[model samples]
Target: MTLRWSTLDTDAVPAWAELTNLLAKVDRTEEYYDAEDLAEELSEPGFDPELDSVAVWDGDTLVAYSQLRVSLALTYEGTARAMIGGGVHPDWRGQGIATRMFDEMEPRGRELATERHPGEPFELRASGGLEDDPARPLLSERGYEIVRYFTAMQRPLPGDPLPEVTDPRVGPVTPELAEPLRLAHNDAFASHWGSAPQEPEQWANGMEARSLRIATSRAAVADGEVLSYVITGQWVDRELYISIVGTRPSARGQGLARQVLTASLAAAAATGEYDLVELDVDSVSPTGAGRLYESVGFTPVRTTATFAKADGAS
Candidate 1:
C-alpha cells in the first residue's frame, strides 16, 4: 500500500468525536471524547487552528492526524515549541509514516512566524504521549527526550476518605467565594512550567457553555478568604478528569491541596458516574507532586517526552 502524509486542514479533519472513537478502537477501549470538549479547548484565546495540524491520506481517506500548541517559553532554555496528538491509525502502523510525519512537521514549524515577548526568550516545546503499547519506541528515534513522566492516576470510588482535619484554615467553597478561588487557582499555578494563566472569563464562559461539573470543584478557605483550590470537572462517560489542582503560596505547606483534592474525589465518587479519577503531574515539580499522588493511591501508568527541532538546526 502506498502512503502519503500531508498538512491537515483543521476544519476538514474528521470531527473530534470521530477521531476519538477511532482512537478507542486502536486502544481496545470503548471510551472516546466528544466534539464539544475539544472545540471549547480550541476555542480558547490564541488558538490558531491552521498552523497546528497534520493529516495522512490513503488515496482519499484521512487515516492519521496530529495537532499541537505553540506558546511562549519560560524555561532555563529561554525558548521552546510544543507538539502533541501525533498518532498513526492502528491499521497504518509499521510503514514509518509517523516518523515521516515528524520530519514533515519540522520545516513548517520553523518557517512559520514566531511571536516575541520583549523580556522573554523564544523556545520550542513539543509533547506527545503513547500508551504502554508497541509504537512508543519512535519517540527516541525522532530525537524526542523523555524529560517528564506522568501518571493518569486513579482512586477507587463510592467510599469517600475525607481526612480528619481540625485546623481553622480549611473549608468548602461557597457561591460568594468562587471568584477568589478562581484567582487563587491562577496564582498558585504560576510557578508551574508550561502552564498558561487562563483568562478570568474561563470560570463563567468556559464552564457555562459546557458541563464543568461545578458540583465537584473543591476549595480551601481561610479566615473567610479563599486561598487555594482544585477546579474539578466530570465527563459524560463516567470518567473524572482532574482539571487542575492549585494552592496559593501562603497556603502551600499546610496540606490544603490534599484536603481539597480529597474533597473533589469525594464529590466525584458521590456522583456514581465514575469509579476512578485521573490527573497528570510533572515528574520534576519541586513540590514532589508525584510522590504526594502515589502516597494517595495514584500509580504510574505511562511517561512522555518533550521533543524539538531547532530552527534549521540539526
Candidate 2:
C-alpha cells in the first residue's frame, strides 16, 4: 500500500478507530476508542485539531496516527508538558511509519510548548507499556528517558471481600455534587507528581463525558462537603473501571477514600453487572495510593513508563 501523510481531517475518525482496534488486539486490551472519544479529544480546551494531530494513510485507510496535547503544569518548575500518543496499525509496524509520525509530533510539540509558555521550561513526554515495545526504543533513541511508572491494577468484584465503613457519609455521585467532587479531586492531586489542578472549564467538561457513570460512582461527604470520591465508569460490559480516585489532603487517614471505593465496588458487585474493577495508580505516589489499592485486593496487572525528552537534547 502506498502511504500518504496529512494533518487530521474530518474523514479520519473511522480510520483512527480502526487503527486503535488493531492496537488493542496487539496489546490484549479492550478497544480504547470510538467516535465520541475522538470528538471529545478534539474538543479539549486549547486543542487545535489540524496543527496538533497527524495521520498516515494507505490509499483510503488510515494506517498510523498521533496527537500532541499541551497542558500547563503548576509544579515547582512551572513546566509545560506536551504529550504525544498514538499507534501504527498492527500489520503496518516495523516499517518506519512510527518514526515518521514522531517526526511530525516532536516538532509540533515544541511549537505548542512555546506557544503555551514562551521562554519557559517544557518537556516532551510519552507513555507506553512493555520494555520491548517499539515505542520504547524509538523514544529512547530520540533522547527520551523514563521518568515515572504507573500501574494498572485489577480486582475481581464477584465474591471479593468488601471493606466495612461506619464514618463519613457515602453515596452516589449526583449532578449537584459535581463541583464539590471537582474541588476535592483538585485538592487531592495537587501534590502528585506531574499533575496540575484541572481548570474549572476542564473539570466541568470531564464530568459530562459519556464514559463517566456518575450514578454508579461514590463520594464521601462530611459537613456538606465532598471529602473523597471514586469516579467509576464502564470500560466494557464486563468491567467497571475506577476512572479517578482521590482523598482530600485534610480528609486523609479517616479512610474516606477506602470507604467511597468500597461503596462503588460493592454497588458494582450487587448489580451483577461487572466481573472486575480496575484502576491506575502512580507507583511512587507519596499518598501511598498503590499500597492502599493493594489492601483492597487490587493487583498490578500492567506497568506503564513515562518517558520524556528534555529541551536541547538530540
Candidate 3:
C-alpha cells in the first residue's frame, strides 16, 4: 500500500476529525470532537502544527496521526514534559503505523522540550483509556512506564439535588474575569503532579475554546480576585464536560471549589440543555478531588493511565 506522510495543515481538519472520532469509538474512549474543535486546537499557543503534528494518509483516507506539545514551564519536579497525543485508525492498526508515527513524534517532542526548557530534565508523556488499551503494550515496549491514572466521572444533570452556594460572590464566569481565573488555576494546580503553569497565551486559548460554555461555568470572586472556578465545555450534544475545577491555595478549605462546581452544575441543569456533566480527576489526587467529585454525585465511568519515558532513557 502506498502511503503519504505529511505535516498536518488546515485542509486536513475534516479528515483528521473523522479519524479521531472513529478511533474514539473503536477504543471506547467516549471523546469526540468536531472539525471546528480541532481547528482551534491546531491554533493553540506554542503549537506549530507544521512541525509538531504528523498525519499518515492512504489514498484520500487519513489512517493515523500524532501531535506533540511541550509545557511552557517546568513541573514541580523541575522536569519539562512533552505531551504526545494521537492514534491509528482501527482498520489500520497492527501495521506498524502507530510505531512510525511515534518514531517521528518522540524525537520531535524531545527536541522541542529541549529547545523550550534549555537544560531542564524532560520526559515524553502519553495516555490511553483503560488497562487493556492497545497502546499500552506499544508504549511499554518503547521504555515508557505507567506514571499516573485519571478517572473519568459523570453525574446526571437535573436529577439529584445540587449543592447550595450561599456566598453571593459565586457566579457565572464573565469575560472580564478570564485573566483572574487563569491566575487562580495556575496557583491551584502548582503542586499537582506533572502540572505546569499555563502562560497567558495558553490560558487565553483555553478560554476561547469553541465549546466553552461560559454561561454555565462558575467562578468565585472576592475583592476582585478569583478564588475558585469551574470551567465547562461541550463536545457531544447534551453532555457538559467540566474542564477545570480549582481553588487557589490561599483560598482552599473555604469550600470555594465545591461551591463553584456545584453552582456550575446547577446552572447547567437549569439550562435544560444537558443530560449529564463529566470531568476527569487524578485517581490519587493530593487534594482529595476525587472524593469531592463523588460527594457531588459523580461516579467513575472509566480510568485512563498515563505513561512516560524520560529523555535519554533506554
Candidate 4:
C-alpha cells in the first residue's frame, strides 16, 4: 500500500467516518462522531482547515489524521495555546504515522501562535485515555508532559423518582436567563486552571449555538440573580449530555448545583427521551465537583490525561 500524506479537505468525509468507526471498534465502545460534530468543529471561528490539519492515506484510504487547533482567546494574556486531537486507524498504528503527524503539526502550531501572539511561547496540547491509548507514548516521546487528569462520568437515568426542587425560582432556562447564566458560568469557573474568560460571541458560538438545543437545561435564580445552571447539548439517540454546569461562587454550599442537576435530569427523564446523562470533571478540581457528581449517582467510567509540550520540542 502506498502511504501518502496531505491536508484534509471536506471531500474526505467518507474516509474520516470510516477511520472513526474503526477507532471505536478497537476501543470496544459505541462512541463515534457523527457528521454534524465534524461540521461543528470545522465551523469553529478560529479553525483554519488548510493550515491546521493533516491526513494520511494508504493506497487511497485515509488511515491517520491530525489537527492543530489554536484558541483565539488566550486563557492567560501573552500565552497562546493550541490543542491537538486526532487518531490513527487501528490497523495503522506503530508505523510512525503518529510521529509524522506531530512533526507536521508542531511547526504549524508554532507558526499560528507566532502570527497570533508574537513573542509569546506556543504550547501544544493533546489528551489520551489513561489506559490503552496510543497517543500517550508519541506525546511523551515528543516531550509532552501530563498537565491534568479528567474523568468521564455517567449516570443511568432509569426514570427514578427525583427529589423536588423547593426553590420557587428553579425552572427551565429561557432566553432572558441566557446572559445571566453565562455570567454565572464565568464566575463559577473563575478559579479553574487554564480557564479563559469568554467574550459574548465566543460563549454564544459555543454551547448556545443554534444547532444545539437547550431544552433540557435548568437553572436556579433568586432576586434576579442566576445562582446555578445546567446547560445541555444536542441529544444523541437516548443519551443526554451536559455541556456545562456551575454554581456561582457566592452561591456555593447552598446545594444549588445539586438542585439544578437533579432538576435537569428529572426533566429529561420525564420526557422519556434519555437513558443516560454524561459529563467530564477535573480529577483534582478545587470545587470537589467529582464528589458532587458522585452524590448525584454519576460514576467515573474512564480517565483522560492532558499533555502539553513546549514550542519546537522534539
Candidate 5:
C-alpha cells in the first residue's frame, strides 16, 4: 500500500476525529472528540498545524497522525516539556505506522523545545491508556520511563450525595473572575509534577472552549482574591468533565478545594443535564486530592500512565 504523508491542516479535522474516536473505543480510553473539538485543538495557542502535526493516509483513508507541542512556560524544575499525542487506526496498528510517526515526532519535539526554551533541559513526554496499551512497549523500547499515573474518577450526578457549599465565599464562576481564577490555578499547580504556569493566551483558550460550562463551574474568593476553583466542561454526551480543580498554596488546608469542587458538582447535578461528573487526579497527589474526590463519592474507573524521556541541553 502506498502511503501519503502530510502535515495537518483544517481539512484534517474530520478524519482526525474519526480515527480518534475509533481508538478510544478500541483502547477503552473514553476520549471522544468531534470535528469542532479537533479543530479547536489544532488552533491551540503556540501550535502551528503545519509544523507541529502530521498525518499519514493510504489512498483516501487516514491511517495515523501525530502532534507535538512544547510548553510555553517552564516547569518548577526549570525544565521544558514537549508532549506527543496521536494514534494509529486499529486496522493499521501492526504495520509500523506508529513507529514511523514517532520517528518524525521525537526530533521535532526536541527542536521545538530547544527553540522555545533555549539552552534548558527538556523532557519528551507521552501518555497512554491502560496498563497493557500497545504504545507502552514502544515507549519503553525508546528509553521512556513510566514517571506518573493518573486516575480517572467519576460519580453519578444528582444521585450521589454532594457536600454542601455553605461557605459564603464559594459561588459560581463569573466573567469577572476569569483572570483571578487563572492566577490561582497557576499558583495552585506550581508544585505539581510536570506542571507549568499557563500564560494568558493558553489560559484564555481553555476558558473560552465551547464545552466550558461557566454556570456549573465554581470558585472561592475572599477580599477580591480567588483562593480556589473548580472548572467544568462537557465533551462526552451527558457527562460533565471537571477540567481543573485547585486551591492556592496559602489556602491548602482550609478545605477550600473541596468546597469549590462540591459546589461545582452540586451545580452540575442541579442542571439535570448530565448523568455523571468525571475528573482525573494524580494518583499520588501532593494535596491529597485523591482522598478529597473519594470523600465526595467519586470512584476510580481507569488509570493512564505518563512516560518521559529527558532530552535537550542540561
Candidate 6:
C-alpha cells in the first residue's frame, strides 16, 4: 500500500464524513455522525486543524484522516489524552491503509500535545461499538486498554407523549436564575462519574454562542434557589442532543430532574425541532441516570468502550 500522511486543514472537508457513511453499511450498530455532530465538532473550540490533524492518502485518493484534540478528559486524569480516528472508504478496506494511519497518528498526537502542555505524558483515547468491531480489536493490539464503557441513549420524541410534567416545582430557565442553575449543575453532577466544576462565565458564553433553543431550558426553583435544570440543544438534523441536565442534592428526591427533562423533551416535540432526543451517561454513576433516561423512553443505542494507551509504550 502506498501511503502519504498529511496534516488536516480545518477549512478543508474531512474524509471521516464520507468514510462514516460507508462504515454505516458495514457496521449497523454504530452511530457515527448525525450531520449535526460532524459540523459542530469541526467548529468546536478545542479543534486544532493544523498540527494535530492528519489525512491519509493512497496515490492521490483520499482514504482516511484522523482528528485530534488536546485537553483534560473528564473520564481520565493528569496525563494527556487524544480523541483520534479515521475511516477507510468502503471500496478501499482490507488493505493496510487503516493500520498505517493509526501508526502515524499515535506519535503525531504525542508530538502535538506534548508541545502544548510541556513535560506531561501524552495518552490516546479511542471508542468503539464494543461488539467485535474491527477498529476495537485493532486498538487493543496497539496496547490500548478498555478503561470505560459509555452508553449512548436516545429518547424518541415524535409522538409528544411524555410522563406527567406538572410538578409545579419545575419551570423554564431564565436569565435571572442562571447562577442558581450553575450551582444546581455543579451539585447534581458532582457525585456522578467524571464530573468537574466549570465556571459560570464559560457556561453562559457557550449557550450564547449558538442557537441553544434557549427558550425551553427547564429549572426547578424553591425559596429563590435553583434546585434543578435541563438544557436542550437544538436539533440541527432531526437529532436533538440534550446538552446537560442536573439537580442539586436538595432537589434529587423531588422528581424535579425528571419533570424538567420531560418538559424539555415535550417542548422539543412541540416545536417539531427533533424526532429523537439523545444523551450519554456514565454507566457507573450511582444516581441511576441511565435508568432515568430509560424510563423516559431512551434506550441504549450503542456502547463505546473507552480505551487508554500510553504514548510510546514498551
- Location of the lowest summed lDDT over 10 successive residues in candidate 3: 305-314
Error of 3 at 264 (Å): 0.3
Error of 1 at 110 (Å): 3.8
Tens digits of per-residue lDDT, candidate 6, 59-137, equal 6566777777655333224466666765667567778776777776777777767775678766777666557677777
TM-score of each: 0.77, 0.93, 0.98, 0.90, 0.98, 0.78
Candidate 1, residue 56: the lDDT equals 71
Candidate 3 vs candidate 4: the lDDT winner is 3
lDDT of 2 by residue, 1-314 (tens): 58888866667887787777778768654546666667677777877888888888888888888988888544434777888988888779899988888888888888888876888787888976566567888888889899998888999976557877666499888898888887888888888888867777888888888778776699988777899898987746678889998999998998888888888888888888888888888889989988888888899887778998777256
Q: Which ten residues in a row have the lowest lDDT in candidate 6?
A: 69-78
Candidate 2 residue pairs that clash = none
lDDT of 1 at 160: 43
**Candidate 2 lowest-lDDT run of ten:** 71-80
| Model 2 score (lDDT) | 0.81
lDDT per residue for candidate 5 within 1-314, as digits (tens), equals 78899988888788888988998999999998878988898889999888888899987788899999889989978999999999898888889888888888888888888888999998999986799899999998888889999999999988768767788999989988889988999999998988999899899898899888999999999988999999998889999999889999999888888899888888888888999988999998998989999999999999999999887322
Worst window of 10 by summed lDDT in candidate 1: 116-125
Q: How accurate is candidate 1 locally (lDDT)?
A: 0.61
Which residue segments of model 5 deviate by more than 4 Å?
Answer: 312-314
Clashing pairs for predicted structure model 6, backbone only: none
Query: In candidate 4, what are the lDDT values of residues 44-162, reduced to their tens digit?
Result: 67787778888899887999988788767565434588888888988888888888888888888888887877877678889765666877887888899998998889889864467
Candidate 3 per-residue lDDT, tens place, 1-314, comes to: 78899978889999999998998888888899999999898888889999999999998999999998888888878999999999988888899988988888888888888888999898999986688889999999999999999999999988789867888989989999989988898898988999888888889888888999999999999998999999999999999999988988899898888889989999999899999999999988889999999998999999999999987375
lDDT of 5 at 281: 95
| Candidate 5: 10-residue stretch with minimal lDDT | 305-314
Candidates sorted by lDDT, best first? 3, 5, 2, 4, 6, 1
- lDDT scores of the candidates, listed in order: 0.61, 0.81, 0.90, 0.79, 0.89, 0.70
User: Candidate 1 vs candidate 2: which has greater TM-score?
Assistant: 2
lDDT tens digits, residue span 63-103, model 1: 77776555433333344444455566777788877667666
